[model samples]
Target chain A: MNFTRRFTLAGLLAVLLPVSATVAQVDSLPSWNSGSARQAIVDFVGRVTREGNPDFVPVPERIAVFDNDGTLWCEQPEYFQAAFALDSVKAMAPKHPEWKQQEPFKSFLAGDRTALAEQGEQALLTLVTAAHSGKPTDEFSKSVADWFSTARHPRFNRPYNELVYQPMVELLAYLRVSGFKTFIVSGGGVEFMRVWAEKAYGIPPEQVVGSSGVTQYQLDAAGKPSLLKTAKVQFIDDGPGKPSGINMMIGRRPILAFGNSDGDHQMLQWTMAGSGARFAGLVHHTDEVREYAYDRQSKVGKLDEAWDEARAKGWTIVDMKQDWKTIFREKP
Target chain B: MNFTRRFTLAGLLAVLLPVSATVAQVDSLPSWNSGSARQAIVDFVGRVTREGNPDFVPVPERIAVFDNDGTLWCEQPEYFQAAFALDSVKAMAPKHPEWKQQEPFKSFLAGDRTALAEQGEQALLTLVTAAHSGKPTDEFSKSVADWFSTARHPRFNRPYNELVYQPMVELLAYLRVSGFKTFIVSGGGVEFMRVWAEKAYGIPPEQVVGSSGVTQYQLDAAGKPSLLKTAKVQFIDDGPGKPSGINMMIGRRPILAFGNSDGDHQMLQWTMAGSGARFAGLVHHTDEVREYAYDRQSKVGKLDEAWDEARAKGWTIVDMKQDWKTIFREKP
Candidate 1:
C-alpha cells in the first residue's frame, strides 16, 4: 500500500466515526440541561424520587396520574371518547326507532360532526349515556372492541390507537421505569376505555378510571350469569370529580399530573398542592401542518382557562410545534 | 510465603468456593425443568398471550384475575376479613346500644373465639353485615385503618400487616414481572380490604373485588357531602362469584391462580380451563412449627376437595414446611 493511499483511507474513517456518534445522539432525548423548562421537570422528579432526599417520597406514595385525552393523546377535532360515542350511536342506529328522529342522534347518524359539536357537553353526555348504558357491561366492551378494530381517525387516516403521541408514550414508559405507578384519570367511560387501555398504555384496566354508570350482576334461569348496566349515573369523572376519583380509587394524591384543558385543571392543582416535589405540564397544540392545531377558543379540547393558569402557576407548556420531534407512530 | 503455606491456602479456597456457589443458588428459585404441570401453565399462557399466537387474546380479552384471603395471602385460625369484622364490632361497641345483647356482637365483644366459631358462616355474615354496613366508604376505611393499627394477631402477636408470608409476596412480584395484572377476589368485605391494600399488596383499591354492601352518596344537613351504606347486598365475591367478579371487574380470565382451599377451587378451575398457558398453585400450610398445620378438615383455612383435585389437575403444591426457607418478613 502506498503512503498517500493509507493517509486518505485513515482520514475518511475519522470523519465517518464522528458522524455516526452525532447520529446516535440525535436518536435519544437531548441533554436535560438544554433549558430551564425541561430541567424543572427533571429536577423535581429526581429530587422527590431519590432515596434519602428530604422530599423523597416512599415507594407506596409514588403515584403519578395523567389525564388521558389531550394530555397523553391527541383530542383534536373531537375527544376520542366522544368519537367512540358518535360511532356507537351510528352503529346502533338501526336498532332504535327514537334515534332516527332525535336531533343529536340524527346528526351523529348522518356523520354531521358540525351539528353534533354544536350540541355541546349536554349532547355529548346524552350520546355517551345512550351508547354506554342500558346494556350489559361485557356486551358494551365487546362493541367497543369491534368499533376500535374498524374505526380510523378522520384527519390522521389511522386507527385511533395509532394516533397516540409518540412522545407521551415514551414519557409513560419513562415514569414507570422510574418507579411511578401511572394511572389514567379521564372523563371517558370507564368500561369503554379499560377495554383497550392495557395493550395501548401498558396500564391495567383497574388502573384506568373514568366516568361510570351503575352496574349489577344477575343470573339467568339456566344459571348463566352476566353483568348489567343500569341507566343510573354513578360518577362523572371530570373537573373536581377527577381528583375525587383518584382519592377514592387510588387512595393517594399524585405527585405529577399532565393535562390540557380546564377539565383537567383541578387534577393538576391537586397534584401540585402536595408538599413534596411535583410536576404539572400542559400540552399546547400549536402545530397546524403535521397535526391539527387549535387551543384557547376551540370548542373541543378548549385550553383558555388552563393556558392562563399554566403560565401563572409556572406549569411547563409543551409547545406541540417546537417540543415534539414526532407525533404518531412511525409509518412502516 | 513458603510454597507449602501457599499450597495449603489454595486448597482451602477451593473447598470454600463450592459451598459459596451452593448458597447463592439456593437463594433463588430451584432450576426445575419444565415438567407436564409447568408446561401446561406455560402453554396456556403463551397461547393466549402471543401476538397472533392463535389463542392470541386481544387487549379486552386479556383479563386475568385472582382471589385474596386464602388464595393470595395466608388465612388461618380464621379468615382475615372475618377478623377485621370482629375487631370493628368490638371497637364500635361503645357507640351502638344493640351490640351488648346481640348474639354475634356479644360473642365478638366478649373475645370468645370459640363462641364465634360455633356460630359459623351465617353468624359471621351477620356480624360482618352489621359492622361493615351503614357508613360511607371513606368513613368505613378510616375505621378499618384505626382498628388495624392497634390489632395484633392472637397467635403471632404481630400486626396483621407483618403476618403476611414473604414467599407469597415474592411470587406476587414475580408474576407482575411476567406481565400478569393481579386482583384480590375474595369473600371479604370490599370496603374494609381496599383501604389498606395499596400499602400492603402494591395493588390499588380499585383492583380489589370482594363482597360489597350498597352505598349511596348524598348531601348531609348544612350541605356536607357523605356516603351512606344500605342493607342491600351488592355482590358476594366467593366461589363462583370469584370467577364472576374477575370477569366483571377485570373483564379477563386469569392465566395463573393460587389458592389454599375449596373456596378457591372454582377460580383455579376457571383459570385452568382458559384456552392457553395457565398456572395454578396451592399453598399447603404444612409447617406446624413456624406456622399452623391444618388441612382436609380444619374449620379455618380448610383444605379437602381442592387438595385432592390439585394433584390430579397437576397444580403445583407449595409445601410451606419445605418449599420456603423463610416465611415472614425478616425482623429488622
Candidate 2:
C-alpha cells in the first residue's frame, strides 16, 4: 500500500527478526542447508500437517521415531554407550581382581580392541553386563548421568551429550511443533539413553524404546522399594527388534523414521510400509571434515545394508557434509 | 453493596456458575462421597500440587498408576478380559473343530466352570492364547472392539466399557487437572487395554503397561508391514511383574498408585515406597447391592493379603458402599 522504504530482503528479515531468534522462525531448520534432504523433510512434514490436504494425518497418529547413535550424534571411535561401559569396566575393576585373568575381561582391560573383536559379541556382552548391570536402577541411572556429565568423545573432545547433531535437534523440534510425537528408538541401552535423551534430544523417558535388561523390584527392611537391574538382557531394540519394540512400547505404526545404520533397517521398513504419506531418511556420514565418514566398512554403526535399502526405496539420504550447515550445537 | 444480594450458598453457587458445569468446579470429584476416602485423595493431591509446599512434587513427577480391572471397573464373576476371552473362544470354536474333544477347550465350550476350574490356570491360559494371539495386532484390536460393542456385564446388563467406576473416572480427571499424568498399569493384556483405555480412562496407549504376549513383525508381498501377535508370553504385569513392567515401560517410579487386589500388591508397595508425599489406594468392593462384593476367597481379583497390608500400612481402603455416590459411568 505504501512505498515509504526501499529495504533489501536481508534488511527486511533483520528488521523482522528478534534479537535472539528461537524455533518459531520462518526457516524451521536453520542448521540444515538448502538441500534436497532438508527440502524432503520440510515437504513431508508440510503435506502431513496441512489441514485440508488428502495426506493430512491426525495429531495422535503422527508419531516420528529416530535412532540415536550416528543418526542423532557421533558414533565414530566407538558408540558413546560403549565408551561409558569401558569406563565402567575400568572403574569397577578394583572390586573384581578376577577380571585380570578373565579372557574377554583381560583383553578388554588391556585396551586390546583387536583381541576384543576376535572374542566376538558374547565376550563384548560379558563386558557390557559386568559394567552395566547388578545394581539398583537409580544407581545405574545416576552412573549414566554422571558419565554423560564428565565423559567426552574421544574424537570430538566434548561431552558425549554435546556431540548431538544440531540439524537433527532442529528437525525434532520442528516435528514436535507440527504436532508429531517424537520418540528415540535406538540400539543403545534404554537406561543409558533415558538419563540424557530428554536433555539432549527433547524426548522423555517414556517415549524412548531401546535395549534393556530386566529390573527386579526389591524391598528393603525399612520398607523402601527399589528396582535392581539384573544381568539378563530383556530386549534388543535393533534391526528386526525395532519393529517389535515399537509395537510393544508405542502400539502404533509411526509415519516417520530416521537412522544412519543397518540397525534402523527394520524400523524404517516398518514406518515406510504404513499406508499413507510416510518419511524415512538415512543420515550418511560423508562429512569427514566435521564428523567421521564411514559406510559399508565401519566396525561401529555399520551403514551398508541400510544405505542400499534407502537408495532402493528412494528414502532421503542426508549427505551430512553437503546437507548440514552446522553439525554440533556447541563449539569445542 | 452485598446487602442487596442476600442469598443461600446453593443460590450463590448457582448464580456464579454457568448452565452446564465441568471439571473447573470447586468439588473436583463430584461422584465421590464426603468420606475419608475422598478426603484422603483430595488431601494427597492438594499437598503434592500446591506450590511453595515442602511436599509439592513437580508436574512431570506427578505420575499416577491405576490397575484397570477392579480398581477402575467391575471384576465380579470374572474379569472383563476373561469374559472377552470366553466370547472369543466361542467365536473361534467353529474354526478349531478339535476343541470339541479337547479337555480345557471342551470344558470351556460346554460352559462347565467346575471342570475348567479343576483344569486350573494353565487350562485358562491355553484358551486365552488360542483366542487372543496369531492375528495381526490391528485385527485383534478390531475383534476386541466388536466384542465390547456387543457384550454387556451379566449382573448389570450394561456394556462392559460402560462399567468403569464413576468415582475413579472423576478421580482420574481430577488428578489430570492437578498436573498428574494418569496411567493404567493393569494385569490385562496390554494390546487389549490399549484399544479402549484412551477413550475409557483418558490414558493413552503408550502410558499403559501390562501383561503381554510377544508380537512379531511381518512384511507382506505388497511391502505392507504388520505386527503379528504370537502365542509366546512375554511379561506378566501382576504381583512382582507389575513393578518390573512399570520400570520397563515408564522408567520412572510413580508417586500415586491404585489397585483392588493382591495382583497389584507390588505396584502399590513400590509407589508408596517412593520418597516424599505419596498415595497408595485400594478400591475395596463393599457394595453388594450396587456391585458384587468379594474378597479373600474370590478366585478372580482376590483381595486377601493386600487387604491386610492396606490396614497395616495405613493405605486408603475405599469402602465402595460408603465412598462412591455412583458405581458405573452409565446406568443399565
lDDT (C-alpha) at residue A37 in model 1: 55
**Model 1 chain A: lowest-lDDT 10 consecutive positions:** A19-28
Q: Between which residue pairs do clashes occur in model 2?
A: none
- Provide the TM-score of chain A alone for each candidate, in the order shown: 0.84, 0.90
Model 1 lDDT tens row, A77-179: 7887778887787778889988878977878777788998898878777887788777876688888898888988898888887777777776775566555
State the C-alpha lDDT per candidate. Answer: 0.69, 0.85
Interface RMSD of each: 13.5, 11.3
Residue-by-residue lDDT tens digits, candidate 1, B60-171 = 3444455666555567777777788777777678999888788888887888879988998888878877777788666777888887888888888877766766666655
**How accurate locally is residue A18 in candidate 1, as Cα lDDT from 0 to 100?**
31
- lDDT, candidate 2, A282-318, per-residue tens: 9999988898889899988899987887999799999
